[model samples]
Target chain A: MDVFLQTLVAGILKGGLYALIGIGMTLIMGVMGIINLAHGQLMMVAMYITYVLHLAGVDPYISLFVAMPALFLLGCLIQRFLLNPLLKVDTILPENQVLMTVGIGMVLTEIIRFIFKSDYKSVSTGYSNATFFLGNISFSIALGISFIIAIAFTVAMFFFLIKTDIGRSIRATAQDKDAAVLMGVNTGRITIITFGLGSGLVAAAGCLLAPVYYVFPDIGGPFTARAFIITILGGLGSTVGAIFGGVTLGLAESFGATYISMDYENIIGMTIFVLVLLFLPGGFKRLTKI
Target chain B: MLKVDAIDVFYGDLQVLWGSSFEVREKEIVVLVGANGAGKSTTLKTISGLLRPKAGTIVFDGVRLDRLPADRIIGHGVVHVPEARRLFREMSVEENMVMGSLAPEARKKRRETLAWVYELFPRMKERRKQAAGTLSGGEQQMCAIGRGLMALPRLLMFDEPSLGLAPILVEDVFNIVKRINKEGVTVLLVEQNVRQTLALCDRAYVLENGSVVLQGTGKELLADPHVKEAYLGL
Candidate 1:
């Protein structure tokens, strides 16, 4: 029972961070109607930025602001310069944009490899290994802080989507592109902003995870797969569903690592993903209806 | 006032409209009556900047609109309540209306326009919090019109607004269009419901196979033999 409780606590903490990453991918999916295969690469870029700032004696937490905005700009550039032009290209397959993103992911990974040499790197903050006990469960301090911050960001994002005009415009664009255009939404620009916002959200997750997870040029591939699974598990574009999907994945991974084998952690996640596709095809969003 | 002067529109080499010319004077209820493939909707789309004209120009109040994008076209107060009532399905009725006022100029008058839209379509006010997709067909059409009104448009265009409604609802929609026109907004309506639209509009244009075949006052065209045979089935 004690071991079960400890595992549950750890899973929830990790799930919070996963929710942040999932939310970004889901947002991009919702607005652009294209899965961003480079989403994990964007996070990888943010992690590298956080690492560089950490090396310069800046705290990882403080680098969150820098990494997020930098990523937002980078995302805007990617959408405007790379993705937007594809809308005009005559293609037999509508998945050309998806293929373009895969290419982008490869390019980003290669560029980072060229610069950082694929070395496994990590940030060692003061609380990187610190732990606290609550009853029988022990929580890592870094994970706890990240969990709180992730919740804050999620709440903030919810308010932004519901309360703000620009956020409403984003939702409108996602719902119907032609209608949004007729409504004077400048939807092209909205896509750019949505991409930026998605990148910014994932950058926060990357910064939060820097202290806990090792960073490397090739680390993006796994996270990219994880993010895709979460989006599918959560429903394609539902924000609330992303949170549930992320948590479910985190718990599954945690339990698998604890009871089965660490080597099967990813396999466990993939198995759940397949089950979700087979059964709840619309994902948790169909359940939540949000 | 809006004037579309001899514009050609194509959908990937298959021309949908060929040198179609029409004009709407200020405060007038102008209707474009045609069959399914007569380019009625295509004309409205060209005016709204959804599809750029291959040749010729569209002028609204003396400014050329042919070169602008769809989003920018709304800034000139040319709001299109598109065919099939393309309301944001996942959004609430109120959110849909709010989206209608997305332009900076329209946003300034959002509260006023929203109140007026509610006044025009009180059912929309009651269903403000309901998701638009869940609404009945008539209610969805009402919401679509209400959304267009929220833009505070100088020229409001409707594309086949009465396409799928019952006879009673169709009458209600026409009355609403008349009421909207009386409120000082110029109307450019495209419809296949020929007799009723001609009866309501001040002036009417008859389109056949992507070109304007006839144009005159509503009463004049209603009496024309060509119009009666081609459109009114008389």
Candidate 2:
């Protein structure tokens, strides 16, 4: 029973990080309708940035400021130069966006690997392994910090979308591009900004995960899979849905790993994803606030 | 003043507007009446910079506006309240209005313009916090127009604001158009509802199959034989 509780607690903490990562992916897709296959690669780049900053004697938390804006600008430029042209009309077929993004992802990964090498890197924070106990379940300080930061970022993003003028334009463009332009919204600019903001969030996630997850040039693949699964499970374009979906998946994985063979955890997760797609194509729409 | 002088717009290989010339003098309401595909909406789209004319130009306040992007066009005091009441449906009514004043210059005037928009559509003030998607069709139309008004347009172009509204609501909307004009905002209205459109404008243009087939004062166009037969249904 104690073991089960411990696993459950661990899963919930991990789920918070998943939510942090999934927020960017979900926002980019839901609002922009663009599946950024390069998203995982962007996160990988962010992790590399964090590693470099740590090597230079900067704290991971402080590195977030540099990484977020830098990644944001990179995202904006990528959308403006590479993705924007592809977005207009379908040069590629329906499923080709994924392939195109995958190609771009490979390029980004190779470049990062060439610059930084493919060796494993991890952040050694001051409270890297410190933990707090609540009864029999123990939670690491890093996990707790990640969870708090993730929730705060999510709330801030929500407030920005609902409260600001520019935020309204972003939401409007997301819903109806033509209409938004008609109303004098520079949708092209909005698209670029959305891309920047999405990648910026991913940078923060990268900084958070550097201490916990093993980072490497090709480490984005499994992270990409996790992000894709969480996004789909939460429904495309829903931030709150991403959080709920991430937590649910984390719990399921934790329980499955304990009761069943740990090796079959991937199978169980994939099965739930498939079932969700089959049953609820919209993905937890009832749970969405608006 | 908004002048679309002999402009030709094409959708790829197909010509959508041919030598389409019209003018809306400051503070006057000009109506474009036509069938579904007569290019009324396309004309609005071209003027708003959504569709660039392959040939000719658009001038507002004696300045060429043909080269500017849609959002930049709003800075020139020409705003388009598109067809279908394209309010940011998921967002609140207030947010939709705020989005209208997106240009950096317009942001300076937002508070005053917002006050005017709310004054124009008082019901919107009551439902300001409500999601625009849930508003009634007539209310949504009001929200859409109110949003355009938030830009403080010198010339407000409305494409079928009467669409999907009750007859009484249509009358109310046209009355608001007249009121907006009287308040010194020039109006260019496009509508399939020929009778109501004719009843509301100083001048009218009849477009057919992407060309301006007839042009006259509102009363003249209203009494023309072709307009009477095809548009007025008399």
For every prediction, compared with the true complex, DockQ reads 0.86, 0.73
Which candidate wins on DockQ? 1
**Can you write out model 2's per-residue Cα lDDT over A1-290, one digit (the tens) per residue?**
89988888878877887787787888778656867788888899999999998999998878988999999999899878877777666453865556767887899899988998888878888888889888977888887888788778878988887788777778788888888887777888888898899899888888888887788999887677777888888888777788877787888887889889798777777888899899987777555754
Model 2 gets an lDDT of: 0.85
Q: Which residue segments of model 1 deviate by more than 4 Å?
A: none
Weakest 10 consecutive residues of candidate 1 chain A by summed lDDT = A130-139
Worst 10 residues of 1 chain B by lDDT: B67-76
Best by TM-score: 1
Encode model 1's per-residue lDDT on A4-52: one tens digit a residue: 9988988899999899999999999999899999989999999999999
The sequence of per-residue lDDT tens digits that candidate 2 reaches over residues B184-224 is 88899999989978977999988988888889888998889
lDDT of 1 by residue, B24-113 (tens): 999999999988898998898888888999899999988899978888989889999999999999999999999899888889999998
Best candidate per lDDT, number? 1
Report clash pairs, candidate 1.
none
CA displacement after TM-score superposition, residue A196 of candidate 1 (Å): 1.1
